[model samples]
Target chain A: MEILLSLFNGILIALEPINLGLAVIGVVVGLFVGAMPGLGSVNGVAILLPFTFVIQSFTGGATSPMIFLAAIYYGAMYGGAISSITLGIPGASTAVATTFDGRPLAMKGMAHVALVAAALASFIGGTVSNVLFTAFAPLLASVALSFGNPEIFALMLLAFATFVGLGGDDIPKTLFSICFGLVLATVGFDIISGEPRLIFFDITGFSHGIRFLVLAIGVYGIGEMIWTINTSRYGSSMSKVDVSWASMIDAMKRFQEAWRGTLIGSLLGFFVGILPAAGATPGSLMSYGVTKMLSKNPKEYGKGAIDGVAAPEAANNSASTGAMLPMMTLGIPGSPTTAVLLAGMVIWGLQPGPLLFTNQPDFVWPLIGSFYVSNLVAVLVNLAFIPVFLWMLRMPFTILAPLIFVLSLVGTYAAYMDMFDVWLMVFVGVGAFFLRILDYPVAPAVLAIVLGPIAEPKLRQSLLLSDGDFSIFFTRPIAGPITVIAIILILLPLFKVIYDKIKGKPAEA
Target chain B: MRRAEIVTAVLLGFFSVYLMWKSGEPPAWDPDVPRFANIGMIDGEGPGSGFWPFWLSAIMLVSCVWIGINWYRKKSPPSVSEEPFLDSYGKRTLFFVGMGLLGFLILIHIIGFYGGILVFMIYYMRFLGRHGWGITSLVSVSLVVFSFFFFDIAMRIVLPKGYLEPLFIPLYDMFL
Candidate 1:
């Protein structure tokens, strides 16, 4: 209740005309950033992060850090959806599944409607997630308090298992990629034994560990470009996606019919986001799949289904907020974006554990409050400006492609203030292209990299707590079921193949 | 699928064996180095901390082999054409990798980050795409300006100044 009141106070602070203006500007800029191919939320945020440092240098305070960071966060979220619908190019990963149907809808001359649905779904998801945050955050935080190292370890194991199972077709190859990620994580100084694993290069760059800014930008950002060039694959040309009152009415009706998907997507997103390693992409995929399964017209899916766009967009936004719960309560980052937020917390000299609520009510509550306001703002901004973004589609790729290239370089350079990072992006991008060819999925590698370092220490910590007893994984009630479920999922495909062969039935991947 | 599986199995088997052989050697350690009793059924103090990874790789190796054998020994033959593997990917691969390598080589030299991007984008968007000069020039210039403001001015993050350092000084003064 006190948290709610504090949130209210924060909302009041965020409602200031100045902050509101900043929010509008941030959302607009963020949308453009997201719409551009080769630039994404991480790049958007990272590109913007250094400016905050500059702002601090000029103004010498952390008064508006949350506002700036939140704006970028919300803006990136909004931006990612634009390209997916119109251009069939997903600017960010969370929107990959969105391209499956959103592009089809655009092709059917309903691009405006699809865009509106996605933007509105994003709003509804964000708002509902905030309400849930207001209602259940303290409760969720309290629940996390009971989780010891063993439960945490089990959770990481589940994450690893899910990455292998859900990421792609080849389980063994995915596992191999994951193992490679784990090996990469093992580089730098070991936190437990203080032993360096793979620092063969005695260079300072290898010492502090492989920065995600470097790796993500390299592998996904640069690697993707190289792969695209290698494949010589040309994107389908975009058409003018004009917003009309008729389309707006049509979108509203579709929203009415698929409101259930939005709600379910938000709920699932919130739940998945609450778990560590269960970030927006998985939440989006799960929500998308579940929505399809429950839909009356499942056949319409992957064929311009409005619910398809609504579900994943809503899921991604809701999960974005969901990711905050673990970050706020447990002091553990639930996603890379949240990890950046954690870094911000450190930058501001504010600790992020349970005590964050007590100590920095002024800082925390207002940020939470702004999330509510921002969602409303994002929807309005998107609806009113749909034509503007749609106009971007008409711009020749010749113009847009170079523009994207320049942004990519700038984004890369800004993140680390080093050309080495930019170069790294090229290397990683090229490598990623090859890996894609070999059917080695990059998402699992990323997920594994994100979860690996955290898992090792937690497992070691659990062992020490239980006096080296491995049974602690199963002896605990909360952690055991999750572990069991993960293991079952891993075996499901293999068992199904066997069962089909034995039963003289057809096989399915 | 059979051929791919066979290749994977062979690769995994070879790599796993190599890893175990290489990592199994005892490292020259200081007295302060931590040691744990090996828990494996292998002779002597069993495998060390590195042993688990080796064994896990071995299991992966075995699994790959099993899957490969199962695929190869299956009674049915593949039905459809597998022409995707035979398609021309070489030109694209070389250009893509070459472009990326060039991006690195040119960084911090004549063409800075922004300049390098401009060049890369022109070649990619114009030469590769066969785009008109008007659109390419506009996009290239706009990207550079946007990047400058976005990264340098708004974010206060510095990009590589390089040879363009002189030009950046004035812009930096204006923005900073």
Candidate 2:
């Protein structure tokens, strides 16, 4: 009853004219950005994050900007399907599974049907997962309220361990990348004491620490620009994207055909999304595989099966919503996009944890409210503006690239009115470009930077409480199990290599 | 790729060692106070300033050494390939675009935010991107004007004007 009342209040807040307008704007921008090849939600959100400062200044509160950013996140998931269905190009990595059947359907000249089915599936998945999020986030936060410093430190350790274990095929590289980020995080003044840690002898900016926004824009925005330019392959044909009442009715009729896959996908996606380092890419891919295995026409799996298109599309959307659960409840992000959102929340001075739900119900409820509204807005806006978004693709990259570059520079500069940050952003961008070439995951690095500050303090506090006894992390009941899980995750990769060697299979590097 | 992997590992290993060394350094030293006390626990306090950083740096050093071993054993996946980091066309694009960004940084320091954007856009579009002059001028002029109205006029966030500071007085008087 309390949740319902709060949700009602949140809905009321979301209905405000400015909030609604921002939601619409967010969805539009998300769709346009997502439809662009190689520019996923991470890039979309990072590039637009600095603009939220402008919005916050206009609105005089963090709530509107939060709503706007969340809406963009939800909208990007919806938009990612457009290119996958039309051109067989996954606009975002999450959309990769959508191309398995989506392109086949387009080849059959049912492009409109495939597009509508994806949008509708995405809508259903998001709405259902959001309902679960609204109910479970508070419950989980209550459980998290009992967590002590040791337990919190254990949880952060588990997050890092999971990234190393499941982040990629290369464990050592992943560990190195995360440690590098943590090292970078240690660069400013020591939080415990007043002395600076890693400040280069005379550089003034190093004393203040590297801003999350600066690094994010540099890596995702500027680094992505360089990557896109380097791998330019812009000329491609797109399927006709005309949606009418007739096509809508056809899609709705086919919904029954793919309902089972959609259900499986939504449930599986939500579950996977709750786990650290398991993002929409894995969620969608897993759903596609499971749906294929269970299908009656398994041979048609990759040959334009509507269920193939429905399953992954549904899964990725639900997974996006599910990723928000841990972020809001425990302040641990489940995926990269949520990591960015977590950083945004921190930047707005809204700490995302149990205290947030209790102390700032206004902020929490409204954000949850926007999730429900934004998903619906995304579906409608996507359906309505298909042609418009496709037309946006016609805009030349030569024009777009320079514009994005300028936006990045201006945005980074706008954050602190500092030229030093702009230079820092460029330097990070260059480093990020190199990192990407080496196939080292950048998300873990970014997450490490965000979690490092929180983890360091917790570790210090726990040690203080336990008189520097490291066993405190293993003796406490909650911390014990969490630490064990973290250890197990860290060892999993080594165990796999051993198992592979025992089986006489070529061990994976 | 193998060479790149080795270089990165060695560089990270050095960085970790440097961090460990730096983490042990205290702000001050006195005969009355315990040496390297910051990295250890105090009698009443649980841990001191350098405790977390010192331990984390140690862990990082171990991880870096592990990476080095993997690289040496030719067991690292990244070390298995000899792929060029970037092809000729990609290298050209990176070089020109990077130079453009460098120019942007230098120009921002000299010409101010809006002025810098104007010149950067014109240079990037006209020279680097090879877009025609008309479109470049159009984009450059519109971006400067839009940023002026948006950040300066509407939001009241005054960006750096550099030498163009005097030119904005009348506009600010009208807007503000």
How many clashes does each candidate structure show, in the order listed? 6, 0
Off by over 4 Å in 1: A1-19, A29-72, A80-118, A163-169, A199-265, A268-316, A319-369, A385-410, A417-424, A438-440, B1-67, B70-81, B84-86, B89-93, B100-110
Model 2 over residues A316-388: C-alpha lDDT tens digits? 8899988888888889887889999899989999888768889889898988898888998999998786555
Candidate 2 structure quality by residue, lDDT tens digits, B4-116: 88787788778777877777666753445453567888777667776766777777778778777877888876777877767688778788889989987887778788888
Candidate 1 chain A, poorest ten consecutive residues by summed lDDT: A228-237
Highest lDDT scorer: 2
**lDDT measured at residue A448 in model 2 versus the true structure, 0 to 100:** 70
Error of 1 at A95 (Å): 6.6
Pairs that clash in candidate 1: A50-B155, A51-B155, A51-B156, A222-A429, A223-A429, A230-B92
- Cα-lDDT of candidate 2: 0.76
Give DockQ: model 2.
Answer: 0.43
